[model samples]
Target: MGFRLPGTRRASFATKVASSKSCEVPKGYLAVYVGEKMKRFVIPISYLNQSSFQELLSQVEEEYGYDHPMGALTIPCREDVFLNVTSSFNRC
Candidate 1:
């Protein structure tokens, strides 16, 4: 089975994008913006502890310091690469 975050609820992509308000992250999750289009994804806060994810955070820090123009955590990578990295977490 795929690894699912404890409090995650499966939402259709369109529903997720449409339903998610600009600042409405749930209690156990945080929102991140990714890719050139700045698509938003709500992910478990636990991901912050993953080394690979931390590396991505580091990249963001280097590129944007403490001032993210999007006013949220923004990952500076292609959507496919971000998906590949996070998907690997499911296999562990």
Candidate 2:
């Protein structure tokens, strides 16, 4: 059987560019784009404790090899995530 996903969550799954090379956005995550054309994307993380979250961010930076993929990063929801606003580096 084939499984299909919804539109709004397009970025949630892997994508293949015009090159035909398939690329996955990494499981358990979704990227938020910046600017009108959706140029850049940044990861989101929940759980307050600002300090701890920052630490987690540091780790993500190390793994992603880029400090703040975009000019902003957001952690949607406090206890339960919904959507990350990363456009301004804070919740939307």
Q: Pick the candidate with the highest lDDT.
A: 1
lDDT values, one for every candidate:
0.70, 0.35
Total backbone clashes of model 2? 1
Candidate 2 residue lDDT tens string, 1-92: 11113342444432222112233344544444333343323233332334645664565466554545444453222311122322223322
lDDT of 2 at 51: 62
Q: TM-score of each candidate?
A: 0.74, 0.23
Distance (Å) between predicted and true CA of 18, model 1? 8.4
Top-TM-score candidate index: 1
* Model 1 C-alpha lDDT per residue in residues 28-87, reported as the tens digit of each score: 777788889887787777788889999988887888787768888888788778776765
Residue-level lDDT for 45 in candidate 2: 34
